[model samples]
Structures are given as structure tokens and as C-alpha cells.
Target chain A: MRHRLKDVAERAGVSVKTVSNVVNGYVHVRPDTRARVEEAIAELNYRPNLSARNLRKGRTGVIALAVPELDIPYFAELARHVVTAAGVHGWTVLVDQTGGGPEQERVAASGIGDHMIDGLIFSPLALTADDLTGLDGIPMVLLGERVDHGPADHVAVDNVAAAREVTAHLIGLGRRRIAAIGAQRTPEGASARLRLEGYRAALAAAGIGYDESLVAPASAWHRADGAAAMRQLLASGARPDAVFCFNDTLALGALRALHEARLRVPEDVAVAGFDDIEDGRFSVPTLSTVSPDKEAIARLAVELLAGRLAGERAAPARELSAPYRLELRESTEGPADA
Target chain B: MRHRLKDVAERAGVSVKTVSNVVNGYVHVRPDTRARVEEAIAELNYRPNLSARNLRKGRTGVIALAVPELDIPYFAELARHVVTAAGVHGWTVLVDQTGGGPEQERVAASGIGDHMIDGLIFSPLALTADDLTGLDGIPMVLLGERVDHGPADHVAVDNVAAAREVTAHLIGLGRRRIAAIGAQRTPEGASARLRLEGYRAALAAAGIGYDESLVAPASAWHRADGAAAMRQLLASGARPDAVFCFNDTLALGALRALHEARLRVPEDVAVAGFDDIEDGRFSVPTLSTVSPDKEAIARLAVELLAGRLAGERAAPARELSAPYRLELRESTEGPADA
Candidate 1:
């Protein structure tokens, strides 16, 4: 009484390929077609047990996502969105915490791939172009980078443009001396370098000299790092009119540090940040930052991975730069006059 | 030559079963023995393709997690923690969003037992004892409620005690008129009902009459629903000096509604929430809430599922409620003296 794929396809009145694609969660299939195919399978009581299917197809119906750490709220939120999007394609996600170490990134990449995940969605903090060479033959979608070491797709926010716009917003408010806080160098295509370049561009446009002392170094992207960096900048006696943090976590830390130092926000010093996380909206004084469309990025990443899994071939890799919007809030614009 | 399980056992000087346990990520193995086996694996360059092994064992290296929704910060954070914990065991997670529907809950249970996943960690918002008829023979770890219809391990917060303590805190603050906000009834074993019972207990201890008019009903546990419910409660002219929301999301909406009505927090009406989310910490004036150890819950849930997958009948239909801590902050207590 076992049902076969052919029987399901015949009952659904579709081509066998369509039924196959539907069962595999291929995104190209129309919703109605998928519904019909699913109905047919249900009527036939046919189940494609992944363990049994793996024997013949060598596809485990799993994908791996390697991010820095889920403990970080940003990554945690991103992982949630990604997992939700992956579920639409009926794919399971195996998460890996790289802890932003080069060695760990390599290990996660190899370990998950060796475990037979069909593809990888990697947001590597420490892996460089050279390190990506070993990732060949694995279908991957790179997040936070533009490197193309393998035949992989890339999805990222344009860090340079987003940073430039955020800096310009601060400059537009008549802030002359602006300090930038982030990593000075990193193995993962230099987020700090790109952000710094954007900061310089904004300063140059405003006819201000880029002060080397204004650039603060952070070992990692966290609130504590941001707090420490801000402390160092304040202790150096260079009183910048404004501070532009790389991310919301660091910005929150910077805000805490500024609060402890008894400096008034937007009055004594304007503050700006990137990545408008949910926390930013609810901070004591709502944060002004560049808002990236996380939902859109997640949806596109999952769609791209699903396409590859469904035998969509060798298309030119995509680089989706999520558009950023500047949200003017209480922190940078001062409290609303009641 | 390919390294076999026996080869790894010989190299690590362990029994074949011990080597197998190490490979399968069983939790009982000694740390030193596991380390030795891992070192041996590295030295031998052993690559155990999980897909190939799954074919032989009839087990997919994946588990399903059914939750109400990820849009809520609590569930989103929980999913992130769960996925990270499951990854330590080399297991992939297939997330199912039930949207708090009874039908969806039933479908999730059926989907897991249909061999789409090797096990399940379910946080059911719907489906009662009556609907649990067909869920036998599935390895599951129930979350939120202790369903008596099946034999499964459960991990949840002490909702009754948490609610009571939170209410008592508000009462101790000298707020006489207190109200509760949550679902009145649901098929998911009445989480809101239990919390309300705790609220009643606190009120009885304080000699305050339980005003039925003050309790607000939400169709679902969402911010918009809370906002609407609060608006209705305010329109009814039943003013409570303090309010206890079932969760942070609802409390956030209540805060917004109160602000719009020109009622300042902890000045005219105090507010307390459950689930100490990151947003709660950053909320304007910060939220006072019942904080659960989400990391500990996630670890326990994954460990329990791992134990069941290993065919260990260690416990039957167990329910373990983690302790909840009350975080005193500006929402219920006035802002720190400026």
C-alpha cells in the first residue's frame, strides 16, 4: 500500500518535475501548484522521509548558518528571522557560533559541510578571502561580505553607503568634530575599514579634516567594547561634538558611558548609530540610527538558498544591498518639546 | 583508507558504543573521554557524513520546534537560544510557526511524527488534552504547559508563582487598585488563567477586592491586541492605580497607550510586565518585569530531547518550572532621582 511519487503526480494532474519541485520546497513553483501537489500527497498518504530520501538523493534537507554569536541581540534577531524564512522552504537550519574567531569560522564551515547540510549561510566575522578558498563545492550565501571565493551568492547591506549617510546626518546637525567607534581592522572584509572610509567621505564633504585621534578601536562589536572605546576617547581630552557608533550594541554602551560621565545627549554631544535594532527604539531616549530592512534581507537569503537547492544553476551571484533609512529620534534631535 | 567506527574506537582506546555515543553527541560521556575521541577523530581525519549515517540508522539529524510566532521578542529569543543549544548536539532545527492555533498545533504534532523530524520541542499555544490522541510514539519535549494527555518531559517558567510575586510587588508599592491583562481562556492549558489565579492570590493576601471590571482580555498575546484592550479598559472609566501584564510585549503596548492618554508611568498608573526581554531593559523608563532564565530553559529543553532521542526512559511526564525573578525598574517604580 506504499504510494509513489508518480502516483501523487498523476493524482495532482501536474508534471512529475513540478511535483518533485513542490516536495523539495522549490520556490519557483506557484502556490496553487504546491497546494495541489500537497493535497495529492496527503490523499495518497505519501511521505518523503528525509532520512530515506537522503540515501538516493544525497540531500539531507538541512542548511547550516554560521554567525558570530546568538548571545548578541543583533545576531539573535537575525537568526530568528532567517530560521523563519528557511521554514517557508521546508529546510532545517543548523546554527553554529563562530565566536568571531578565524579558526572557529573555518571549523564551522568544514564541520557543517562535512555533516552533509545541503548549503551554508555564513556570516563569518574572521574568515577572509584566502580562507574561503577551502569552501569550494559548497553552496553558500555569504552575509556581511562581498567576497566571491567560491560559486556563492552574497547578500549584505552596503556598509560604506549606510555609514556615509549616518555620518552625513550627524554633520547636517552642525556637529563639526565627530568620532567614529568600531574595529580598526578585521579579517572578514574589514567592516571597520569601510565604515571609517564612509566617515572620512562625510567629513571631507563637510570641509573638515579627519582627526586620527577621533577613530576609536574596538576588539569586537559589543556594548562593553563600545563603552570602553568611548571611555578611551573621552579620557584623551578630545571632546568631539558628536559620536557615530558602528552598531546599536556599541551605541547603547556608548550611551551608558556618556550617561555615567554626566554628558547630555544631543545637547552637549550628538550621538548616532547604525543598525536600528528593536532596543534602539525603546532606549531611554530613542536612538537615531540607520535602519536596515532585516526582514527583506532574510527573505532574499532564504529564497536564494532555496533556488540553489532546487538545481537552479550558476547564475551570477547576487549582492543585495539592503536600503537604510535614517530615523530621527530623541537622542540626536533632543527630547520633544511638550 | 576510510576510517571506520571501530578504527576510531581502537585509536581512542574506548568501546565501540562509547565512540558511537561521542559521535552522536550523547551528553553522558565524560569530558576527557569525549576530548580524547575528538582528538582521535582529528588525527584520523575521520569524516562521518551524517546523511550517510542517517540512512543506516533511520534517523534524520533534525528536530522540529513548534512555537506560536517569532515576531514576539520572547519567542524569537527563545528560538535563537534553542537553535544554538541544539547545534551543540549537531542537530538541525525545523521551526514551525503555529500562530497559536489549535489546528496548526495538531498539524505540527502530526508533521513531527510523520518522520519529517527525528524529534520535537513544542511550545503549544493551542490544542488541549482532547486533541492529543494521535501524538503517541513521538519524542517530544513540551514547553509552556504540562499536558497530561501524553508522556513527555516539560520545561517552563513558574507562571503561577511569577504572577503572584509580580502582583505582590505592585501591591507592596502601596498601589491599591490593581488590574491584570491577559487571555481569559485558551485551549493551550490556560497559561493566562494560571497567571490570573496567582494575581487573585496576591490580592486576597493584601485584602483588596478582585475587581472583575479591571481585567482586560486580549485575543492573542501581541502588542496591538494589548493596545486595543488597554484603550477599551480606559474608555470604560475603570481606572486602576497599577496594571500587571502577562508579558513584556503587552506591557509595551500598555505603556504606549498610557502615554497617549497623558498618564505618566509610576506617577498616575504603575505598570509591571513578565519576561525580561532586551527591549524591556531599554524601554523608556525601563520595564519592571518577571525575568526567567531563558538560556537555562533552552539548555534543559535540548538536553531533555537529546535524552529521549537516546532511548533513555529516565523520567515520565515530568514538569520542571524554573524560578522567575522580579526586576524592579522605573515603569513600576519612579525614575531614579534625577
Candidate 2:
């Protein structure tokens, strides 16, 4: 015979309501009571029939996570961490890639929340604050950028601060003529724009002229695009002492371009990148980068969403600014004289 | 007013059954009939109320993909491709990382199916064929390794042939004292065992001595583990002309260790790795490695699972041996005379 909730409650010396509360993860339950209920659950080997409960409650016990593209290491790693974190709470994460198109982003956002998932953790690439009107009534946590939706939780690193720090590192290394790649004219409030602002701020602080010509624009955030941007900057005859790429993929491509141009890294042109991907450590003349706590972000996002799902007290919207570590590696260490 | 299915059928000049067939993705309908139904759907803006449909039929349009870990770039990239491919069929992929443990693998497999997901794409790590007993009811496609006990389909690259080809590449370079890293003792059917067997076969064919001392074992598949194994190998007083790492992460770690030891690659110690990750190209000395068509594998897995979900014919158990490319870069290409 299958064990029931009453049996568990009787074994634990708790009321049936208390047992239900513990199973539902009610925050009000005492720790000892929760432990007793858990013990009873373990002893009986009672597994909650989630599907049956979901059927009655009109919930799927699944959440969707929409990212830009996973071919990029940063997003790929982020998705992995998010999936692992969600697994801890017994919630499955459905992944969707928007391919960096505004229409696709909107479609993914609208489609995923239509009874297919209980909530969404969206890291959008194209949608802007203007597109927030259609995203109401959905349980979502925005990542990567701040959307102007009134009351949704958000989890993102401080892109502006991280960029500024990287720029400052290059400046302190005596690289006055530093070029910045990934200068895309995206929608307002996008992470790219914020990063550009930070770069400009760093230049201003260093008393260096911020030349628009030094900002190489890329159409997309791919390695090839970064290479093309670097090539364009080099062809323009503006010999930069250093280059700050928007992300590691672009930085990797830029490094290859520099190698092809017979320009030695740090000795000739210093290079720094963001998002300290695993490959950065192994890259030729290892990359100097800002390492964001991706795992922590994933953990916090999952916990926040789980809290919301259980109908816990309305927690205030949280915007966590994870610390970014500046790794001083071979790429931006500069020449001995400098 | 919301248009009824009957209204859609009448307007499209098709029987209700035919309209239902198109809506449900039934394969029996003719192309012209499907086009008519689709046109009618578009014109009428007939969006199926998935909640109501799910209420009637207890099916969720979600599938689970269980991988060992996404920290491994191969699995990370594979998951990205799989998620994209599954999206084309109006399905979402729920990702689970098993950490290569038998208990976690079993939990992921059973949990996903019990949660009412339509199907699963499982990549088991530690679970052997015997542990898969009593898991026969679900529609699943096994990836990476084969396990008997279910009618579920299997999709994987020929690991033995790929490994042998990579090892042969090293032999062709005239490196007699080649070392193999990432040797792990597991069940006979595991990927590690098969790859090891391939390595042995390649050595035998080349008429080179197989030194058991040269094979270094790693407790896990990570860059740190690779670094430790390489350090141990170097300390053991056995100098190898070449090192064939099991995967790219291990190879990358080995490269780092070699750099610390003041050893030059290709000229002093040639190195090659499997799974040509994007970062491998940017490594200070670009890595020579074997590349698999991960996109093809992802597409095939999604197609197979879709067929099963649609009640299509149980196609023959397919073992797709994707062609592997030997990317010869600076790591394994020494100076002309060296």
C-alpha cells in the first residue's frame, strides 16, 4: 500500500496541516518541526506524486530559462550553473536560446510563460525597456540587463563597474592609447551601453582623450565579429597601446588578429577582457579578465524563484551585484619599462 | 469570439479529423491538407489553449536532457545545440547535471519521466547497464554510451574509432614515446574503457611499446585533474615525446603544467586533445585536437525523440559515427627540422 500524508503526519507526531506546510516549503514552520517531518518522509520513503499535485494545482513544476546564444562560453557556462542550481530545488529548467533577435526574444518570453512553465529566468539580448509592456502577469527574474518592468526580480553583475575596473587596469599599466572593442549601438539600458559608459568614465578619470575612432564597433558578439572589429581598428592607423574587449570571445578573436598582425601581446599591444572563462587561463599569453561569480548568481536566481513559487512572503525585488575579480595575467602585464 | 475547431475545419474545407490531425502534428495528413489547416490557423489566429488541452490530456511538452556536467565544454556545447534543435519541434529541454554519479543519474532519469515530461535524452555517467533495470516505461534516447534494459533508442559517436584516429595522428608525427592521460577504471561499457581500448589498439598498430606507466589516471574529468595528472607523470621520471589527453580540458591543463616546467610544445613535447573547443584555437600555442560535429548529434537526438513522441516507427537503433577532424595547430606542429 502507498503511504499517505496522514501516515507521515502520524509518524512525525505533527498535524496533517504542519506536514503539508513542511512539504510545501512554508517558511513559517519551525526548523525542528521541519526536520521531524523530513525524517518521517525519509523513513517512509514517501515520494510526493508531483505530477498528480501539479494536475490539481494547475502548475507544471518547471521553469524556463531564455538566454541569447550558448555557443558563447559565458552564456553556456551560465546556463549550466543555472540548471545545476535549479536541480537542488527539484525544479527542472527548460532552456531557450533567442539567437539574439528582438522578435525571437519577444516570442520566447511570451511563449514560455503560457502554461508551459511556472516561471521564467530570462537573460535577454535584444528586448529593451520598451518591450516590457507585454511581459506583465508572469513570474520572471531578469538577468544581464535591467528591464523597466515594474516589479520583477533581477540578478546581474555590475557591468559598468566591471568594465571600468578593467579599463583602469589597462590605464594603470601606462597604456594611454587604449582602444575598446564591442562598441555596438544597442537599445538604451542594455549591458553594452552600460559597459561603454564605464569605459568612458575610466578614460575621463585617467585624463586621456576618449577618441570615438578608437571604439571599434561589432555587429554581433561573436569571435569573428571581434576579429573583424580589431582588424578595422588596426587598418584605421590608430595604433593603440592596449585593447579592452567586451567579453572573452571577442578578446580571444582579437588576440588571434594581433598574432596574425605580428604584434606580440602586452609587449606591443596589451589586451584585457571580461568574463574570466576557463579558456582564458589557457589561451596563448593567458588573458587578463574580470571574473564574475556566475555560480553564485545562478544559486540566488534559483532560490528567489523557488521562494516565489511557494507563495512565500512577497520578497522585495533583489538586484545582486556580485564581486568581479581582476586577474592580472600575461595579456595586460605590459613591458618591463612601463 | 474564439473560433472553434469545427469552425476552423469548415473554413479550411477539411474534415474535423484532418484539422485535429494537423493541430496535433499527426503524420498521416497530406501536405496539402496540412497547408490548408495551417493557413486557416494563421488566418483565424487560432492559438491552441495549451492549458485546456493539457487539462484534457496529461502531457507536458517538455523533455529532460541528463548530462554528466556542463563544465565540460563538450557537454555544454552539446546541450546548447540540443536545446536549439528541440525548440524547432515546439518542445523545451529540461537540463539536469548528474555529476557522473550513479545515484544522481538514476534520480534524474526517474524524476524527469515521473514529472510527466513527454520524453528524455539521457547521457548517463556512472550508472552501468545493470542499474538501468525497471526503467523501461519512458521514451528515451541514450547518448554518449549504450545501456541495455530498455527499448529506448541510442545515439552516440563511435568513441573507439575517434580515439584511435587521434592516437594515430600522434603516431604519424613520428612521436614514439606518446603518453596517454585521463585513464579511468570503470565498467567495461563506459566511455573511458572504450577510449582506453582504442588508445591501446592505436599503439599496437603503430608497433610502439605500450607502457602502462605512461597512462596517468584522473579521478575526475576537469582541467585541475589534468594538471595534477601531468605533474605526477613528469615527476615519475618518464619523459614522453607526445601527450594525448582524453579531452580538451585535460589537454589545456597539461599545457599549463608544461609551460610552468619551461617545456616547449611540439618541438620538445607534442600535445593533442579531443573535443576541439572554441578556446583551443586561442591557446598561446593553439592546441591540436579532434573535433566532432556536435550539432549533428543534437539534431539527430531531437529528431529521434520527436519521432518516438509522435508514435512514428521505432527506427533501427542507430550508432552515428560522426566524422572527426584532426585540427593540426601550433601545439603539435614543430619547427620544420624539429
Candidate 3:
């Protein structure tokens, strides 16, 4: 049976008002009375009416984390860190999958639904700067790709530097003919574009002329897309010595494609990817990739959101960069001089 | 700015009572007035105070989904489906990770935190039947593993049948010696135990004596655990012609170990797994496993919770069985007479 405040007070030999004061954290309560009330609460197993309390405070102790898809290992791992970080702030996290759709992104951004969250930590795939205008006063922290002048605090690793490092690592392995997968042409593909620019920069630094034909475009960053792109590259007779995929999923797919085509990894064509997800660590020839500091990113995002929710609404949005490192694994550790 | 009912009332040229009537789904409002009010609500993009409304109704539009871990691809994939299924009921899902800790499981099962959810869909790993007593009145639906006489509805695929089918398939490949990975010897390991039982049953059906050394024990169903178990089996000189893993993650790890040992899959030993996760589909030799109808499990769990929330509290808790099928892939489809 659910215990009422009156029952708790009666059990504690105190009045209902005193019990309410104790439950609400009123500082004027006597220590002995508070102890008695707490005992009664424990005995009765009385849980506070959180909805009613939050209603009066005009704040729900819940936040939302919106991502493109939960099935993606990168997002799932990142979300695990986010949930852990959010727990430090005594907040619960509700997840929303936007499926990379503009309409769903807008709905999540606006927080216009029956279950209103105190804030949102969003990793957008489809939303643009224009879509971020007028956000209905819901605090939000942006993750992944940067939105120019977007009205939210942002947290991410330096994608360009990370990608450039991966490419340079491959070039250092004597891979002159390097193919790039996951080049996106849309404006919303900001992160992919940055990585592509990084790849070109590395090629320029190494005095290797960029080949347009070696750059493959994948509309979506999934295994199927990567596999199809790799197949197209092979079918077109582009015998690149190395392939740099935009992400780990794409790289794994490229590996499968290479396997299907009877091309040995690293021996024939070295492969590299970004985002050191768990799958990469166990792949047949373990993947070489860039490992973003996901925990720091998650912690920073939640801290920024907590700051905004804690009456820092007028503070200028901050852009924080987390760290990233290159994980040179079996996928790219080919012959010293092939 | 957050718009109020009075703002919508003025924009629609109606009284506050009429606006409230339309918003609250009172049927007495005129159709034209309702349309005008809805238009104003749209123009203003007003969102109702969900906490306040839910408090008055003694319900929260939020539900909790407590899983052991999200980084595990299986749970991540299942969470994606659950979130989609919960969306159909117009309810938001808050995710909590228990980390397979009994204390954490108890806290989640009790729902004692500040955020009170209307219902919970819990996939427990450490929680026991006794820990489920006196749940503080939170409607719950259990997922994965059967807890006999537990005070909640349960939804899952038949573990025994799925495991038996997988083993039988491996045995059908003209393999005499079969090994099983992921044998847990704990009370909390209900699903693993059931799968182990099915493996034994399959061996008995085929009139093959069970080899004690062929059964490998993994403390956890992670890639590392699976790899270590497989390594132990190989080190102990157990040259089983086939191996059935409890889950895909374990199978993937085992595959990596086999690769390390220079053993060709399905030539020296055929491999099988359970839970046809996305990773399994993309594995080097695409995994052969049981594909549980995850969408159906998610939908049925949500439907049961919705029923309980919609005044079916007295109904006897249901035990719903979801469908499953074996997906034969490159992992197990060896030569005709290997």
C-alpha cells in the first residue's frame, strides 16, 4: 500500500506539516524530529511523489539524449557513458532515436511532446543551423558535427586532425595509392566533409597528387554502403594500396568486401577507419582507427547541459574539443616497405 | 517563449475553459472552436505541462527500460526496438543501466529514485525472484529469462528450443565432437542454464555422449570472455569439430581466438551462435545463429505494460513467447563431407 504523508506523521508521532517540511528539505526542522520522520519514511517505505514535487519546482529531473540510431555501436557506447555521467548529476536520461530525419530532429529539438524533458543532448545527422532556431527554451548540448553558430553548447573531438592522422599513418606505411570511402556531398554531412578535407591535406603534405577516382561517395555510413562502395571501387579497376573509411562500421564492411574479392588485408591493401568501436578490436585483422575520448565528450556534454539547466541560460554557448588518438592495429600494420 | 493556455485562448478568441476543454480532450467543445484552438496551439507550438497533467492524473507518461548494459550489441539492438515500440504507445522511455549489479538491479526494480516512471520493462541479469517482492507498485514487464511466479509479465523467445535448434544444426553437419561455450554456473544465469540444457538434450538426441571437457564456461558473455574461453578449450587439447556459442558476441570472440590459433572455421571446427545481432551479420564469415523476433518481443512487452497501465492491474501476469528462427550462414555451412 502507498503510504500518505499523514500516515507517516502519525507513525512518527508528528504532524503532517512537519513530515512535509522534512520531505521538502526545509532547513528549519529539528534534528530529532527529522530523524523520526526519516525513520517513519523508511519503515513505511514511502516514496516521495516526484511528479508533484517536480511540478512545484518547475523542473523534472529527467533529460533526453537524442541520437540517429541506438543500434549503432558507436552511439550505444557513447550513450552508456552519457547515462553514467548523467547519473552523477542525479538525473535520468530518456533516449530518442531521430533516425536522421529532419522532422524527428525538429520534434526532439523543440521538445514539443507529452513527456517534456528538462534538457536534450543531441547528436544530429540531419538537422542544420536553420532548423535550430527557436528551441522553446529547452536546454540542449550538441554532439558530433559542429553546426555553425548553432544555439547550443557543443562537444566533439577534432575530426579533421583525427582523420588527417589516420591518413598520415597509412602514408607512412608506404601506401602511395590510398582510396577514401564515405565522402558525403550534402550540407548536413559536415563531419564527413571535414574528414575528407583532412584526407586531402594529408595527401598534399606527402606530395601525392589526389586522384578523384579514388574517392568514393557513400550516401549512408552503414556496412552495406561501405561494402557497395568498395565493390564499386574494385569493379572500376581502382587498385588502391590503401583504403581509409570514414568510420569503423564502413571499414568493417570494406574489410568484408576485400575478403569477398580475395584481397588480403594489409598485405594487398591496408585499411583504416575512424571511431575505435568495440567491433574493431575483435575484427579478424583488428581495425586501425582513431579513438575519440568518448567518456570525456559525454561528461562534458552533460556538464554543459547541467550548467544551462542550473540558471546559466544567458551564458554564451561553449564549443569544447575532446581528445582523440590513433590506434594502429593489425589492419594497417603491413610490411615495413611494401 | 513558453506559451500558456491564456495565450492560446486569446489567439483562438475563446475562453480559457474552452481551450482547456479542447486540450484535455473534453468532448463538449464545438468542432469549429476545437479546430481554431488547435490551429492556435500549432501556431504557438505550445506544449502541455506534462508533469502537472500527469500528477493530476496520478500517472507519468514516461516508462523506464532497465537493461544490464547498452554497449552489448544485443541489448543495444533490443533497446532500439523497444524505444520504437514504446513510441507507438505515445510514451517516452528512460533507460537505466544496472551493470549487472544486484544492488543496482534492486534500486531499478524498486523505482525509488526522483524520476518516477509509470511502468518499467526490465531485462535483468542479477536480480532474483526474491528481489522482485513488494515492488512499490510500479507496473513492470520482464524481458529475457523466466522468473517463476515473479510479480510481472514476461516476454522472451524460447531459450531451450533456440539453443537445441542451433546445436542440432551443428550436429547435422556430420560433426561428432561438438563444444558449447558460455556455460554459467550461477542462479542468475537462467537463460545460459536453459541453453546449456538444450545443448545436452541435443547431444542425447543424436546418441552422442556428452564430453565434459567440451563445455566451456564464461563468466561474462563479452568478446574478451568468449576469446579467453575458446583459448582455454584449445589449450586443453579439446579438438571439437564444432562449437555452439551462447550468443553472437561470444561467437565473434571465439572466431578471433580461432583465427589466432590458425584454425580454419568449418574446416577444423564449425561455429554457431545465438542472437543474430548486426555484428554477426557483418562478421567475416557471416555468423550462423538463431534470429529471435526482437520486434515482436518489444511490441508485446510494451502492449502488456500499456494494458496494465490502462486498468488491467488485476489481470494475471502473462508469459508471452516470441518467435525465433535459425539463420544459416557462412559460419556453419561447410563442405558437403568435411
Stretches of candidate 1 exceeding 4 Å from the true structure: A1-66, A71-117, A146-150, A220-237, A256-264, A335-338, B1-66, B76-118, B129-133, B146-149, B219-236, B256-264, B335-338
In candidate 1, position B83 carries an lDDT of: 68
The sequence of per-residue lDDT tens digits that candidate 1 reaches over residues A1-338 is 76777898899999988877876657778877877886787677575545576656676666767777654667666766786666544455656656576655765566443445677788887776567766544677888753644446778888888888889999999998899988566455377778888889989988999898988988777777888888889999989879999888788888877876778888887888887776666565568998877776776787778777667757767666666688888778987763
Candidate rank order under DockQ: 3, 2, 1
Q: What is the TM-score of each candidate against the true structure?
A: 0.76, 0.81, 0.81
**Clashing pairs in model 1, backbone N/Cα/C closer than 3 A:** none
lDDT of 3 at A46: 70
Could you tell me how far off, in angstroms, the CA of residue B269 lies in candidate 1 after the best superposition?
Answer: 3.0
lDDT, candidates in the order shown: 0.75, 0.75, 0.82
TM-score-wise, the better of 1 and 3 is 3
What is the TM-score (0 to 1) of candidate 3? 0.81
lDDT (0-100) at residue A283 of candidate 2? 64
Q: After superposition, how far is residue A113 of candidate 1 from its true place, in Å?
A: 7.3
lDDT by residue (A1-338, candidate 2, tens digit) is: 66788998999999989988766656587878877887787687565556677778788766777877766778778877887666544456666666666755775567543466777888877776557555654567778864634356778888888899999999998889999988767573376787888899999999998899899887676677777888888999999989999888898889988977789898889999888887777666788998989987886677567667788536766676656788888899842234
Candidate 1 per-residue C-alpha lDDT over B230-332 given as tens digits, one digit per residue, 9 for 90 to 100: 7888899898889999888888788867876778898888999888876666556578999988877887788778777776756566677766689999998
TM-score of candidate 1's A chain against the true A chain: 0.83
User: How much is B201 displaced in model 3, in angstroms?
Assistant: 0.9
lDDT per residue for candidate 2 within B1-338, as digits (tens), equals: 76777887998999988877666656677777876876787677565545565545566666778887766888878887886666544455666666676655776667443545677788887766556656553667778754643456677777788889888988998989889898877563376677788889999999988998899988676787877888888999888888999888899899888877778998778998888887677666788988888887786677677667667646555454545677888889853234
